[model samples]
Target: MISCACPEFALDNNPDTRAAMERITAAEADLLAARAAFYPQLGVTVEYNRTNNPMYSFGNILNQGLFTNTIDFNDPGTTDAIQAKGVLQYRIYNGGRDAAAMDAAINREQASVFDNETVRLQLQANIVRAFCSIVQAEEVVTARQSALEAISASLAVAQARFEEGSLLKEEVLNLEVQQARAEERLIHARHCLSLAQRGFLRLLGLQGAAVQLDAQGSPAQEIPANPDINRRPELQAMAAQIRMLEAMVRQAEGGHAPTADLFGSYQVDRGAEFGDGSGNSWTTGIRLNYALFNGGRTGAEVERAKALLREAREKRQHLELACTLEMEQAVLALHQEEERLKVTAKMVTSARESARLSRLRFKEGLLLSSELIDTENRLTDAQLSHSLATASRTIAIADLRRAVGLPQFNHGK
Candidate 1:
């Protein structure tokens, strides 16, 4: 049996959880990329060209120190030049665009972390439900097996009485019919158990593995008197999303501010042969840019970002409402399942006692065969009901853990 007391048994291997982890990594990478704007950018290029294009040829000759009075101004003739150049640029100012972008990326990474927590919480709840199902199914199968054993025992006694000419053949035949039916019931219960086991295995990502479920029931859980889910991961995720959107709005607004950058370049050129021209030259300066007109694109982008921010805030509001509703619903469900379990436990006790008395009465010729069959069925049904009620209570507690954002459930005792 797989132990769900620790999430690593399933969580580290689950496909959904793995995908969430990847998303977290992706978000972190995006944050790193955003922060790159704070650093200098440098590029190097080396190229050799042979051309007679008027503009480039003249510039190349001047750069290579080959421009002389002897060369005809009208035609510089074909020339081959090799130039190696490096440029460096660093943004001096851009309002707060870079800072806002970095903030947005940080918030996005936070949102991804919360999202992964949400996935893990839901997965824990699902594992609990599946584990409960397997446990319940196993109990049901055992109950049916017991009922079948009781029926077979009664059938044997009836057969002996019929052979001794004391009991009617019809009575024996009725018992025989019920015995067969009880066997069918047992077979079906086992089938359900097998299916439940398979589902549990699938949840743990252990498909086609040999199945064996723990028959031990989960420990009783006390529903918190004032269960609150204000700190649920989903709500936190939405809040992070809203913050990220707010940063995007700020980033957009920064677009209207003029941008300034410091730039420098170094170049070396060769003409006719390598290293035959002006050895090296360097240029450095500060540049400024402002988009005086752009068909209203910048304004449109700012408006769009504001709109998205507004939408995200509204979504967060909706998420808060959802979290409240989920918490209330989970509490109510736990309460109901607890009461149901209590009732079913009493029912099983009463039915088991009744079945036992009926069996004694039938052997003593004080009860009809049909009445015995009815009592047997009632006992089996009560057993199944109690098992179902227990499983339901376990599942409800798991859901409460999920609603409240607990790391993982601890139903094991």
Candidate 2:
């Protein structure tokens, strides 16, 4: 029965994952602001002023209906006036600038969503690679332990033969030396496993979490025959960028056109001397504004925006070619690792048989101690090679999946 358990991908506690999610939220906020810009604004204003000017002194008195009490208007004294107002303003037209800006913001937000997915997939791939490393290292440690045990048995046999005068002291010493070397290798292998575990834990944001990894190697699978770059997040992001640049071009050209807004306000005026005779007024109108010229600034902005659009298109083209090359390379690597794994599997089987035969021959006086040690070393190396080949194949598969923008792995915890 399989005793290993696969990790589940947990993005909740990861710092980089949280950061990517936050970026998407920020982009959403920008999109909302862009949409809100299309609506009208309402505001209230209140003011109190004391004016001593000749024109305002008389005007305030008339406005407040206090002229009857101020019969000596020739002595136009200071006037204290209080005003409260409510204002409404709305942009009726702006040459499609708001539309372009909103479109650009929408594209940016979509791109951010794609970027977040890309980060997630990339992190999952990393986790897969790290876990595979730990699995490979653990296998190596197991292989080394097995080798140590076999060598210790051989050393005991040699010691017994030496005591019975059937083996030389030098042969026994040679077996002891091999035993020591095997033990040394086992120690190194265990250390490698420790390091791999540490790295795996750190990647999961669990610095000291006790865990058992179950990175089972999957059966050999066929590489993707035709991978499409369009589905890739990077390409989608580029496409969004192109759209945003096009929107920017529209926004820049909009500057050459006039803008119109509807504005209205209602006000109440009261004077200190004529508080009971307050007056109210209302005003409303549509305002038109045009930027006649700005020293070629508008023209320059339009040109710049067009240039940026072209640049984005060119970059997308370049990236498409690069992705194609990367996918091809990943596929080729997968095939190579698959072949290497097959060859190493055969080697491991043959080496194990040879080691088993050599142990028997050494015990029956048909093989020298040195010969047995050589066979044992070859078996250990074969096991290690097979382990590495298995890991390489697994990693290659993960890379190919990532190259084709496939989010298939479960990782974490």
Candidate 1: which pairs clash? none
Q: Give a tens-digit lDDT track for model 2, residues 1-413.
A: 22223323445555778899999999999999999879899999898888877788788887787777645667678788888999999998998999999999999998898888788767766776887898889899999999899999999999988899999999999988888988898899889888887777766766656657544443233455676666788899889989988999999999999999999999888988545657788999999999877899999999999999999999999999998888888888988988999999999999999999999999988899999999988998998899898888877877787787776452321
Q: How many angstroms is residue 136 displaced in model 1 relative to the true structure, after the best TM-score fit? A: 0.4
Off by over 4 Å in 2: 1-8, 56-59, 68-75, 216-225, 409-413
TM-score per candidate, chains pooled: 0.94, 0.91
Using alpha carbons, what is the TM-score of model 1?
0.94
Estimate, for each residue in 235-254, the C-alpha lDDT of model 1 and write its tens digit.
88888888998999899999
Total residue pair clashes for candidate 1? 0
